[model samples]
Structure formats: C-alpha cells, structure tokens
Target chain A: GDSVTQTEGLVTLTKGLPVMLNCTYQTTYSPFLFWYVQHLNEAPKLLLKSSTDNKRTEHQGFYATLHKSSSSFHLQKSSVQLSDSALYFCALSPSNMGYKLTFGTGTSLLVDP
Target chain B: GALVYQYPRRTICKSGTSMRMECQAVGFQATSVAWYRQSPQKTFELIALSTVNSAIKYEQNFTQEKFPISHPNLSFSSMTVLNAYLEDRGLYLCGARRTGVQDTQYFGPGTRLLVL
Candidate 1:
C-alpha cells in the first residue's frame, strides 16, 4: 500500500519569512507526488507536482523537488505572504493505481503579519 | 484548463437518510473521476474511482452499496451516500482527470455533508 506523511501538523510563520513544509512518501514503485493548497472554505488547488527524481518544480512562487532516493518532496517558498496561509496537503498517486490518490494529514500554514 | 463543479455545496441529512451529490467537469474530458472524503479531522480518503464504461472501484472499507457512484458520461458523475450517519459527515470531493492521466486530479468545491 502507498502512503503519504507530513511531519508537521501546523506551521506558523511571520510574513516575509521563508516557508518549508515537509512531505515524505512510501510506495512500492515509481510515484507521482503532489502538493495541494486549500484556503478556508475553498476547494483544494494544486500547488506543485513531480514524478521525476531530483527535479525541482515551481508554481505560484512555491517550489518542490522530488528526491526519490530520500522519498521526499518538501514544499518551499523563499518568502511567505499573509495570503499564503492555508491547509496544505501532500499526496501520492500510487504506482499502477488508476487515478487514485493517497493523502497525508494536512499541515495548516498560518502566516502572521 | 479544466474545471470541476459539484452541486449542493452543502447538505444536511437526517440519520439513515440518503443523499446524492453531483460532479460535473467542464473545459476538458474527464476520463476518470475519483471520489474522496475529507473528514472533519481533515484526512483525504479515497472512497472510489469511477471510469467511463468500467466498473467502479471502491477502496477498502468503502463499498458500492454504501457509496454508489455513477459515471454515465465523460464529464458528469454522481454519488449517493446511503443510510448516512454521523460518521459519514465530511466534505465529499470529486476529482476528475483529463485523458485518464493520474498525475493531476482537478478537485471541485466539495459537497459538505452534515449528518444529524
């Protein structure tokens, strides 16, 4: 079975500071990893995704690099803004599983001004 | 670009009642749709996968009789939660994928279910 793990349950940061949300996963074969952000009362939107190993993908000022050797795809941002606060999820598309996703217990990011 | 829409953004049902939620995909072909439940504790659990012209696949602990899904076309789907209870209360999200590509699943504003 495939699974995703986010080490932090909540991460609070002051505006303009750096942001890092840890994500790790376990799978039997090659996997597709994704980061989804959900604002209060909103649907989850994709932030970034990667399947290739050791390649960094960026979107909306956020970036993540998939490290297959370490089985990690940690989301990072150089500078955080107040609007960046949201519930972030790390998910895995299981190998050979058709369109099914396994998600982690989300990390609530709080950006304080 | 692709977009997913869910009907009845929020619904409240009495215990043991049944409720059905709809999912529609626009701007792209939704070859497959996956249903997930985001519990109050906020864990996204895959309930089932419905593909056009194929049998719906439900995950462990989820059954067709309990969460029956229908994918009659490429762009529309619906799922009925039978005999709803407090434990079934959560945000039910429908994620549709274009061209059966599992890499990206565009999610819709979920149907929030409240069982009482």
Candidate 2:
C-alpha cells in the first residue's frame, strides 16, 4: 500500500514571500514522488518529479528535493506571485505500478498582493 | 506533445441517474488509464485502473457495477457512474500513461459532476 501525506491544508502568503508545502509518503516499494498544481477551473499539471533521494528537481521556478531518508518531498518557491495561487497535490507511486498515483490531501496556496 | 482530453467539462444529474465521461489521449497511445474523483474537502480517491488487455481493477468501496469502464483501444477510454448520489458530486479526472511507462500519469481536464 502506498500513500502520500500533505501536512498543510492551506498556506496564505504575500507576494514575493517564500513558500513551502510539506509532503511525506509511505510505500512498500521504491517510490516515485510528484508535485501537481491545479489552477482554478483547470486540470492539475505535473510540476516536478523525482525518485532520487536528496536530489533537488526544479521546474517553473518551483523546486523540491526528494529525501528518501525522511520520506519527504517538500515543494518550495523562492518568491510567491499572485498567479501562484492554486491547489497543490503531492503524489506517490511504486516503481513497478503503471500510473497508479496515490495522492495526498491537497494544499491550497493563496498568494495575495 | 501528449495530451488527455475529457468530455463534458460539466454535468448535472439527478440522484439515481447515471452519467458517463470519456477520456481521449492524443499524440500517444494510452495503454493504461486511471480514474480518480476529487470531492470537496477531500483528497483525490482512485476509483479504478483500466489497462488494455487486462481486467479493470477497482479500489475499495468502488465496484465495476457502479463505475463501469471500457478501454477498447490504446487512445480512448470511458467510465460511467451509475446511480449518482450526493456523494458522487465531485471532479472526475482521468490519468493515462503509455505502455511501459511506470510512473508517468498524464491527467486530463476533469469532468465536474453535480448531483441534485
């Protein structure tokens, strides 16, 4: 059984502030971690993914490091923007499972002016 | 470029009715498709996993009788929600992956279902 846990329910921040969304996972096998962002009324898009422990993966100004020792892949942004307001989901899947994604309870990030 | 498209971006149905949603993959063959429902205030729950040439696998609390799926080919799949209820109101997403790709689940614009 594989599962993902996102601790933050909602994160509110001002523009230009740094942002972080905590994610942790549990799986029986080697896991692949992913971050998906959903803008209002849009489909969730893949933001970043990594399976290498302690390796930082970056995309679209957002970065996350997969820490297998901690079972965490915390998403971070250097500066928040109004457009960055969205619901972010952390997902996990075992290496052999074909596209079977276990998702966490999403964290809604709201960036205000 | 790969993309997944879901039909009927929004739908309203009365309780006890049924609704069907379609998923189409473009630019690649979708050998496997996974269906998920995102209810308000709740996390995304995987309903089923349908792979070409294999039987569909439904998660706990979900059944093939309630959520029938058809994956006839590599590029298209569909699922029907039978006897909709209040708990069925949510966004239904379809994530697809080409054969041999283990972790790449590309999602489609979900269908928003509102049950009355």
Candidate 3:
C-alpha cells in the first residue's frame, strides 16, 4: 500500500512571502508524486508532478523536486499571491499502479494581504 | 487539451434513493476512468477504477453493489450510487486518463450529492 503525508493542516502567510508545503510519501515500489490545488467550489487542478528522482517539476510558479532518497516532494513558491490560497493535496501513485492515487489529508493555504 | 465533464453539477436525493452520475472525456480518449469521492472536510478517496475492455476494480470499503460503474466506451463512464444515505453525501469526481499518453489524470468539476 502507498501513502502520502501532508504534515501541515493549515498554513497562513502574508502576500509576497515565500511558502513551502511539506509532502512526504511511503511506498515499496517506484513512486510518482503529484501536487493538486483545489480552490473553493472548484475541482482539483494538477499543479506539479514528477516521477524522476531529484528532478524538479514546475508549473504555474509552483515547483517540487522529487527526492526518492528521503521520500519527499515538497511544494514551494517563491512569492505567494493572494490567489494562491487553496487546499493543497499531495498524492502518491506507485509506478506499477499508476491509475490508483493515494491522497493526503490536504493543507489549506491562506494568504493575506 | 484534454477535458473531463461531469453531468449534474449538483443533486439532492432522499435517503434510500439512487442517483447516477456520468463522466465524459473530450479531445482525447479516456482509456481509464477512476471514480473518487471527497467527503465534507476530508480528502478524496478512490472508489473504483474502470478501464476499457477490463473489469472495474473497487477499493476497500466500496463494493460494486453499492457503486456500480459502467465504462462502455473509451470516452464515457457512468456510476450509480445505490441506496444512498446521509453518509454517502459528498462530491463525486471522475478522473479520466489516456493510458498511452502519460500518468497525469485530468479531473472533472464533480457532482455534489446531497442526501436528505
């Protein structure tokens, strides 16, 4: 079985500040990690995903590096925007079972002016 | 660009009733469609995985009798929730993927189910 852990339940920060959302996963097989953002009343959108170890994947100003050694793929943004506030979920999909995604509890990010 | 559309953005049904939701894929072939439920204040849970020409696989705690899924073609899928109750209320999302393309799955807006 595969599992993803997002340690932070809620992260509040001011605009223009750097932000990091912790994400760690556990799996016996090769892992493919993903970061999904879901705004209020909207479907979850893919923000970043990666399968290659140590390779950083970036999309929409968000970046994450898959570190297989530590089983982490923390999402980071250089400058947080007011619109960046949303619920972020870290998911893990074993390479062998790519269609089944195990999601974390999700972290609600609140950005203030 | 690939897109997934879900029918009936929101619905309300009485306890013990049943409702069926549909998932459609556009601009690509959805060889695999996965159904997920996001309970209130909770993360998403995988209910079942439907692949073309293959049997549907239901996850633990979810049975085909309770959630019957049909993937008759590559572009469409439907699932019916039988005997819905208060605990079954949630946002049901369908994630469709083209198996040969990549592992990334695009999700639909989801059908919000409310049980009274």
Candidate 4:
C-alpha cells in the first residue's frame, strides 16, 4: 500500500512571507511524488513532481525537492502572495500502480495582506 | 498541454436519486481515468479507476453498482452515483492520465454534489 501524509492542516501567513508545507510518504515500491494546488472554485492543478531523489523540481514559483532517503517532498516558496491562498495537496503513486493516486489530507494556505 | 473538463460544475439531487458526471480530456489521449470524492472534512477518497480496454477497478467500500463508471474511449469517461444520499455529498473529481504514466494525473474542475 502507498500513502501520503501532509501534517499541516492549515497554514496562515502574511503577504511576502515564506511558505513551506511539509509532506512525507510511505510506499512499498519506488514512489512518484506530486504537489497540486486548488484555488477557490477551480480545479486542482499540478504544481511540481519528482521521482529522482534530492533533485528540486519547480513550477509556478513553487519548488519541492524529493528526498528518497527521508521519504519527504516539502513544498516551499521564497515569498508568499495573496493569490497563493488555496488548498495544497501532496500525492504519491507506487511504481507498480497505474494512475492510482494516494493523496494527503491537504493543507489550506491563507495569505493575508 | 492537457486539459480536463467536467460537466455541471454544481448539481443538486434528492436522496434516492442518481446523478451522473462526465470528464473529457483534450489535447492528449487519456488512457485511464480515476474518480475521487472530496468530502467536506476528509481528504480525497479514490472511488474507482477506469482504463480503456480493461476492467474497471473500484476501491474498497466503493462498488461498481453504486458508482458505475464508463470509459468508452481515450478522450471521454463518465461516472454515476446511484441512490444519492447525505453521505454522497461532496466534490467528485475525475483525473486523467496517459497510459503507462505512474503519477501524472490531470484533474478536472470537479462536480459539487448536494444531496437533499
């Protein structure tokens, strides 16, 4: 079985502050990790993905480095913006599974001005 | 770029009735589609996985009779929640991925269902 765990249920920050959402995973096989963001009333869009260890993958001003040794892929942003308020989900899929995604509980990010 | 579209962004159905939602993939072939339910307080729960030219697989607690899925082609898929109840109230999302891809799932806007 494969599972994803994001401990932060909610993260609140002021504009221009830094952002980090913790994610850890457990899998029986090599895992592919992903981060997806869902804005209010919008679909969840891919933020970043990585299968290689210690390699930082980034997109849309956010970045995450997969650490196979630690079994974690923590999402980070240098500076947060008001527009970054949304629900962020960390997901993983075992190498042998086809198109099946195990998702985290999700972290609701709120950025204030 | 790949885009997934879902129909009837929001719907209201009474208990004991049924509602169907569709997912369409554009710009790329979707060899597999996974259905999930996002509850108000819980994370996304995988409902089923539908692959073209293969048998559909439903997760534990989800059955084909309750959540029937149809993947007739590479670009389209649909699922119906039969006998909707209060417990069925949630956002239903369809994620499409190309065949052989392990973790790349393009998600649709999702249908918000309200059971009364």
Candidate 5:
C-alpha cells in the first residue's frame, strides 16, 4: 500500500512571501511524486512531478525535489502571488502500480494582499 | 498535449437512483483509466482501476456491484454508480494514462454528483 501525507491543512501568507508545503510519502515500490493544484470549484491540475531522487523539478515558479532518502517532495516557491491561493495535493504513484494514484489530504494555500 | 474530457460536468439524482459518467481521452490512447471520488472534507478515494485488457479492480469499501465500469476501448470509459445516496455525493474524476508510453495521468474536469 502507498500513502502520501501533507502535514499542513491550511497555510495563509501575504503576497511576495516565500512558502513551502510539506509532502512525504510511504510506499513499498519506487515512488513517482506529483504536485497538483486545484482552484475553487475546478479540477486538479498537475503542477510538477518527479521520479528521480534528489533531482529538482520546477513549473510555474514552483519547485520540488524528490528525496528518496527522506521520502519527501516538498513544494516551494520564492514568492507567493495572490493567484497562488488554492488547494495543493501531493500524490504518489508507485512504480508498476499501473497509473493508480494515492493522494494526500490536500493543503489549502491562501495568499492575501 | 494529452487531454481527458468527462461528460455531464454536473448531475443530480434522487436517492437510490443510478447515474453514469463517461471519460474520453484525446491526442493519445488511454490504456488505463482510474475512477476517483473527491468527497467534501476528504481526500480523493480511488473507486476502481480499469485497464484495456484486464478486468476492473475495485478498492476496499468499493464494490463492483455498486460501481460498475466499462472499458471497451483504449480511448473511452464509462462508470455507473448504482443506488446513489447522500454519502455518495462528490466530484467524480477520471484519470487516464497510456501504459508504457507515459507516466503522467491526465485528469478530466470531474462530474459533480449531487444526491437528493
């Protein structure tokens, strides 16, 4: 069985501030980690994903490094914008699982002016 | 680019009724399609996984009798939720992927189900 954990339930910050959303996973097989962002009343969109350990992947000003040693793929951004407010989910698909994804209990990010 | 489309973006049904939703993949073949339900205040729960050649597999607490899936081809899939109730109300999403060709699973704008 595979599981993903997003420790923060909600993160509220002001615009221009840096933010980091913690993500950690547990699985028996090699893990493919993904970061998905969902706006209010919208479908979840893929933001970034990585399977290579320790290699950083970036998309839309957000970056995450899959650390096999720590089993973590934390999402970070240098500067948060008002549009960055949304629900962030960390999903894990174990290698050989055939496209089955186990998602975390998403983290809601709220950026204020 | 790969895209997945779901029909009937929103639907409402009476309690104990059944509802069906469809998923279509464009620009690529969808060898595998997974159905997930995102309930309020809860995470996405995988209802079942349907592959092109293999039989559909349902997760724990989900039964084929309750949620039956049909995957007749590589590009399309449909699922029906029988006996819908208040607990079954959620956004049902379909995640489709091309086996061996890519690892990313493209998701469709889920069909929101409301049970009255």
Candidate 6:
C-alpha cells in the first residue's frame, strides 16, 4: 500500500526564522507528491507538487524538492511569517492510480510574531 | 481555474441516522471525484473514488453499502453516510480532478459533520 509520512506533528517558530517540515513517502510506483496548507477553519489549499525527482517545485514562498532517491519532499521556507501558521499536509498519488491522494497526518505550524 | 463547492457547510445528524453531502465543480469538468474524511486530530482518510462512467472504488475500511456515492455527471457528485455514529463524525471533503489532468486534486471547503 502507498503511504505518506510527515514526521513532525507540530512545529513552532518565531517570525523571520527559517522552517522546514519533513515529508517522506513509500510507493512501488512513481508517485506525484503534493504539499497542502490549511488555515484554521478553512479548506486545504494546494501549495506545491512535483513528480520529477531532484526538481524543486515552489509556490507562494514555499519550496520543496522531490527526491526520488530518498522518497522525500520536505517543505521549506527561508523566513517564516505569522501568517504561515497553519496545518500542512503531505499527500501522495501513485501516478497510475488516477490521482487519488493519500495524506499524512498533518503538521501544525505556529509562527509567532 | 478550478473550484469545488460543497453544500450545507455544516450539519448534525442523530446517531443511527444518515446524511448526504454534495460536491459541485465549477470552471472545469470534474471527471473524477474523491471523498475523504478528516477525523478529529487525525489525517484525511480516503472514503472512496468515483470516476464518471466508471464504478466507485472504496478503500478497505470503507464500503459502498456504508457510504453510498453517486457520480452521475461530470461536475456533480454526492455521498451519503449511512448510520452515522461517533466514529463517523468528521469533516467530509470532496476533491475534483479534470479528465486529462491527473495531477492536481482541487478540494472543496469540506462539510463538517457532527453526530449527536
């Protein structure tokens, strides 16, 4: 079975500090990886995705490199803002599976001003 | 641009009852719709995947008899939770994907279900 794993359940940092959220997956087939961010009481929004290994996909100030060799797509940002506080999810879809998503238990990030 | 809308943003059902949530896709055709449940303090668990003109596929813990799905058209789909109970209470989300594009899954503001 294909699955995604986010090692951090909660991450706290101060504004202007660098932050990184770890994500790794397991799949027998090539998988499309996605990063989603959800604010309080809001729907999860697509942050970034990549299927090409070693390519860094970025959106809105968040960037992640999908490393096929390591099966990792860790999300990173140079400087965190208060608005970055939210729940982040790492999802996987085996390319042949018609884009069905298997999400990891989200990591809740809190950036204080 | 793609947007998915879910009806009845929030609802409460009595234990042993049932409720249905609807998903509508706007802007682009939704060739496939997948339903997910986010349990309290937990991650999103896939309930089922419904592709237009194809049979719905349910995960191991989910059954069509328990969570009936109707994906009659390209843009609209509905899922009903039968015999709602404490374990069934959570946020139900519907993700829509275009026919040719098999990468992005646009999600709707999920329906929050409460069992009383």
- Candidate 5: regions farther than 4 A off: A96-98
lDDT of 6 by residue, B13-39 (tens): 999999999999999998899999999
Q: List ranges where model 3 is wrong by over 4 Å.
A: none
In the range A1-113, model 4's lDDT, one tens digit per residue, is 77899999999999999999999999978888989999998989989888899999988889999999999999999999999999999998886353788999999999999
Summing lDDT over every window of 10 consecutive residues in candidate 1 chain B, give the lowest-scoring window: B97-106
TM-score of 5: 0.94
Compose the digit string of candidate 3's lDDT tens values, residues B16-116: 99999999999999989999998997889999999999989999999999999999999999999999999999999999987586688888999999999
- Model 5 chain B is weakest, by summed lDDT over 10 consecutive residues, at B97-106
The model with the greater DockQ, 1 or 3, is 1
Residues B1-116, model 2: lDDT tens digits = 78999998999999999999999999899889999999988899999999899999999999999999999999999999999999999999999987666668888999999999
Weakest 10 consecutive residues, lDDT, candidate 4 chain B? B97-106
Name the weakest run of 10 consecutive residues (lDDT summed) in model 2 chain A: A93-102
Name the lDDT value of residue A70 in candidate 6. Answer: 92
lDDT of each: 0.92, 0.92, 0.93, 0.92, 0.93, 0.92
Q: Look at candidate 1 and tell me the lDDT of residue B10.
A: 98
**Which residue pairs in model 4 clash with each other?**
none
Write model 4 residue lDDT over B1-116, tens digit each, in one string.
88999998999999999999999999889989999999889889899999899999999999999999989999999999999999999999999996556568899999999999
Q: Each model's fnat?
A: 0.70, 0.74, 0.56, 0.72, 0.60, 0.60
Regions more than 4 Å wrong, model 6: A96-98
Q: Which regions of candidate 4 are displaced past 4 Å?
A: A96-98, B99-102
